[model samples]
Target: MKLMKDEIETRRTFAIISHPDAGKTTLTEKLLLFGGAIREAGTVKGRKNSKHAMSDWMEIEKQRGISVTSSVLEFQYDGYHVNILDTPGHEDFSEDTYRTLTAADSATMLIDAAKGVEAQTKKLFKVCKMRGIPIFTFMNKLDRQGRDPFELMEELENLLGIRSYPVGWPIGMGQSFKAVYDRHHKKLELYNPDNPKDIDIISLSGPDDPKLDEVINDEGLVAQFREELELLDVAGDDFDVDLIARGELTPIFFGSAISSFGVQTFLQHFLSLSPAPTVRESTIGPIDPKTREAFSGFIFKVQANMNAKHRDRVAFLRITSGRFKRGMSVKHVRTNKPLKLSQPTQFLAQNRSIVEEACAGDIIGLFDPGTFRIGDTLVEGEAFEFDEMPHFSPEHFAAITVKEALKHKSYEKGLQQLTEEGAIQLFRTYNKYVEQQIVGVVGVLQFEVLEHRLKGEYNVDIQLERQPFSFARWIDGPSKALATLKEKQRNLVTDREGRLVALFENEFQMRTAQDKYPELTFYENSFYKKSII
Candidate 1:
């Protein structure tokens, strides 16, 4: 048990989130570089370039140079077992990002220095706050001319409603960019653009060291930098570790992820400050990692057909409590049955190796034989589910048809499997006399992915025509009210589970129905409340 506790404490699981093109994948590769997970950091320059990001393993992602799904990688750094959840940064994949956050104990919110708080970043930031996950900000893209660090800090507080404390401050901007002042150690790490290969550490007598003046080579810039430091010292928020753990404050680090500057410093500081796997909430109660004896975990994500030859699926489970050994039998809490725990694997993106044992905070991949859903639970002892996993309402809708009559079976099978992975939502509706298959996604790019996967994975082609409906709301009300709603609007459809949904062309259409049928209740998401997401 002591050994198990040690294993849990040594693990640090976190997700990196940002808007698209904020250098998120770049930062993940650099962190992997520090972990020795890869010999060289793979560049995400497009498929034709023959080098793709290590975190993005999907072929579609390789071609598009954008991540549409989350990737998990586990490695060891400085005696700490690190599990990095590399999430999709695009706004289209925000739902995927939200799902990935549940398995993570904390998150590193990457921000583009030029564009401080972006739309997607703000959206994901709220989700992080919903779960109360501690956020550490990395103001990226310092290699180019960018925003004022002080303004960026203020934006975090004003726009995102979180205060930030800089662990290190940049010395200059743009071509004159020189070093980062490590406030804690009172040292300067110089940056040389000509030789941007390694970090140069220089001992400074103080912030006003003449050695720093020699490095900057500009007297006016030195005076301005010193004044900014004095102002920050006088007026900035005090470093409160407790507030940081509570997600109330963020420790900000400024660097360019593309150039790999200040990344090592960020990694070293992040490992020391980040929390280990903490207590996880379940239906029964709070499950404490320090005391629990039985192995338990929940499935946060499910990926299907990762390997073309194997045509297999993986259920990514984050162990909540206790220890798991190979070939152990655990109870499937959702189905109330015993499930054999065999063939557990750990990942470095798509590359994986079978792990003999894993403890709390470790995410392990179990070979899924089309059984696990997004929120299913597996436990060795008490049976309780972690119920916070949410079902988001899809905004974009389309009607899909099999391109060939003979390929109906293939289309159905492919659609079922893809929907099961939670890449898109499946629905059924009627057009005149025939039932039509409808697919919905939060973003339209998923439609392309759906088409691509159907053709590639299952060898079926689909004709996906866009629908006018912009919103879907699950209905809960008296049978008479629902019947009336369907009769009047003819906008009613059912989700995969046969839950009745009203597809509205616009909000006005929804409002007209609501005013007419007062007995009916509309819900944005299927089961969870608004705050839970």
Candidate 2:
């Protein structure tokens, strides 16, 4: 079946985002099931740290029960081919999320019913908004204890400054949670968790049943919904309340992912209304290397997987303009290096297959081509220059010391391979001991994955100790002078925050400096402390 409708010319790609453990993984599994991409949803808790959970691929991630990396899953939905970037929710893995957000046209911000907006959720949402991507809120886990949808909706509005309307309400929550009625379909679907096949649908639009009205009235929710309906009618399809006001069609659906309660209904609504990728205002560029005048594709990330004798390194790219074909050579704007494509592959979780060609608005993986790096642009012309890849300065740094360090040659080779995958940052200072830092968006799960890959793949057991008086200091002078000063001050004090505060001399700078800096001492106390030391 065609993934997109005949009339729909654009593709729709959405990224699922949430705080860690907000059931983002569960939602991804359900969507895959609805599309028949997977026969059964994998339970994250039951699987080995490395094997089962679709998103939790790294060994440490599995053992620690966190998502350390991002995974892309493409499937056909409604009339559009939807590519869902399931991203990691932890802070440590936020860099991955940031990069993935750039790859998506739209975002589905997931919130836990029990835990409304979290730190990671807030962080990723900002990235999406900054990119001007339209977002839809998915308030999940109604069956679990925590905040309710109404509260979450308000929090989202206040915290994120986004205007959203709830498309569905929970039928029941906690223990009595069962199913939800589609606001659009007006049909109630009862959930049968033990036997998912036993789904029952009922229309509640024109029913005169006393029992139904009684339940609605008792909850004081019917009047609320009627008000909502009136407001929606006033709001209209143009998304402007004063203009067309065609009435609100953002139907909300409810479901329990574990029991597959409202999975089918959610999928049906998602397919019916979610816009395709082509409808999105995509960035355009040329593909020809010589004319570099045209739009080209940008590679966001790369992953290496051992399949057979031919191990594959996949480069995930978004076409800004032009078309890319298999076996074509394109120049990377960043490195001034040309990469020959073996094939272009699209992802379904961990599985990837070759595609004939890719056009603008497509996000697919290009197969093994050496000399590829994240944020590299694939352009046709040699002279054309595209924008640099989005900058992500690592905020958190954990210096790892190997308990059983590898041989020098092995260590160098392994670190090179690891850094190329954007896993960690390794630094050597003459004064500070040699250290390997796992730097990126951080989450508990992300760190776990780094640990696993380092130990299992790199054959190194390591301990991470906070660096002594860490500060990313830059002198407001020449590079030579700064380097000299850095060397002099490298071991002066363990007060990184104070050092930075002294440099910036701003309140915001001091506040942020203290929050992130582990060891801090006020400059005023420096003299007294120096004398005491």
Candidate 3:
């Protein structure tokens, strides 16, 4: 089975990751603008006369001006199909971002020119590195005063252990900011802050082009930029296209996303350098994106209630190979059952519409009515499964009880839906059938989101009581050992799926269990050899 070159080469799927307030959302809007996805770019913090960012559609997000979940946006630009995964920069939602990264073939790491690499950026970078995905660096907010370019490069190398190659260089810092020298094309892109959509492009014969001084306007700045360019060319490591594809080296671009300076230049260069949809690993073998085989994809995310008018749950599937068409019958690998995908849709964040057709590297949303789970694989006829999606261990625990006993049904349904979405983990005590249930989450902020959604979506108000347990481990052993552990441990509980687990008061208690019950195996996080559920 073979696909047309145009079909294969025109698709580009990537993710954007950064620390909070690094202008990541702004950069996404500007890219969409270049792609003609939107008529006018919307600011994240909507002004009195401006619209809110399209990607941040949730009501809470619009008010808070932060992305809490990952968004998938598809648009066409210059004869290519671009799929951008705009991920949350907030550290509390890092788990969601981690799952989203698994679906991307490449990543754009945004760094605040003034703050450099921060904690969340490092964590997200590690996930990208683990997948060996190519990363392109964008030093954002160059319009503001920031650290020297030389210092920023050094920090990237030392902190990430990856070599940096500057593709473009900024002329000046802060108010003096003017333009960027495009090293790849030997061109100058002059910035026009007032009319960012219109840029002045000047071609240079070489670094010594005499017209450079005239274009630069400032004679002193021209000489300084020329000297730095000369030094960088002579001393910097040679650009290796292969290394950049292997995630060993990052091509850096300087830009101001808010003002849209240098964004188009970065987008053009990024598409040229980034790899297209590649092969994915499966139980059978590597599935080539160009193979004209049957359609196959896996669920990376399950979002509930994208539309308030209807109680809908959407399962986001990243097509790994072949083509997808509406009303096609495919096998649900996990359940070993065939399902007719009647309503496949494409996303513009929360807003979506039915799509007639899609192909590999495209992210499609399927209408799920309590059937789909994260990491479920779908195929036309193949009987193989992809690698399991990883789940992070939760550090915080709490017991939740509905304030109004009459709303218990709604509370239960909401909890089940949210837990299935991986918003939080649900657990019940084995000692007694209590009305209150325990929940675990990677970060404490998740509790707030859980409460907010329960009240707003389910119309059920709940009270959350913080728990002291710091560690949870899934326990497995013979019936004798299980019974003995359950009798001795007051903190024993079962998850939503009825998996046996033991909660420890502290690290000391966990160690004591390990020492006492040598026959039982304790797992820090639940993982499947084949299916995620």
Q: Please count the clashing residue pairs in each candidate, in the order shown.
A: 0, 40, 0
Model 3 scores worst on lDDT over the 10 consecutive residues at 524-533
Better of 1 and 2 by TM-score: 1
**Candidate 1: what lDDT?**
0.88
lDDT (CA) for every model shown?
A: 0.88, 0.58, 0.88
Per-residue alpha-carbon lDDT of candidate 3 for residues 1-533, written as tens digits (9 for 90 to 100):
33554576888999999999999999999999989888887887654467888899777777678898899998998878899999999988888899999899999999999999999999999999999999999999988999999999999899998889999999998888888999989999887766865789899997689988887789888889989999899998789999999999999999899988888889998999998888889989988877646889999999888887797899999998878889999999888889999989998888788999888889999999988988888998768878778787778999999999999999999999999988899998886656448999988888988998898788999999999988999888889988898888778888877788888879999999989999989998777223343
Candidate 2 vs candidate 3, TM-score winner? 3
TM-score of 1: 0.96
Q: Candidate 2 vs candidate 3: which has greater lDDT? A: 3
lDDT of 2 by residue, 1-533 (tens): 32222322445667888888878888888888777777777777866542466655555656666676788887776555667788887777777778777777667777777777898888887887776665666667666655665566677668876655555556556765555556565665665546855778777753233544554443444445455455544652224332111112223345566666666676665555554443222234423322222447777777765232354567788765556678887776656667677677887766778887655556788764456667666777643544444544333455555565435555555555556666654444334564333333223344456656655665666676554232333223345644544554432223211221122224565456445433533343212221110
* Runs of candidate 1 exceeding 4 Å displacement: 430-433, 486-489, 528-533
- lDDT at 257, model 2: 67
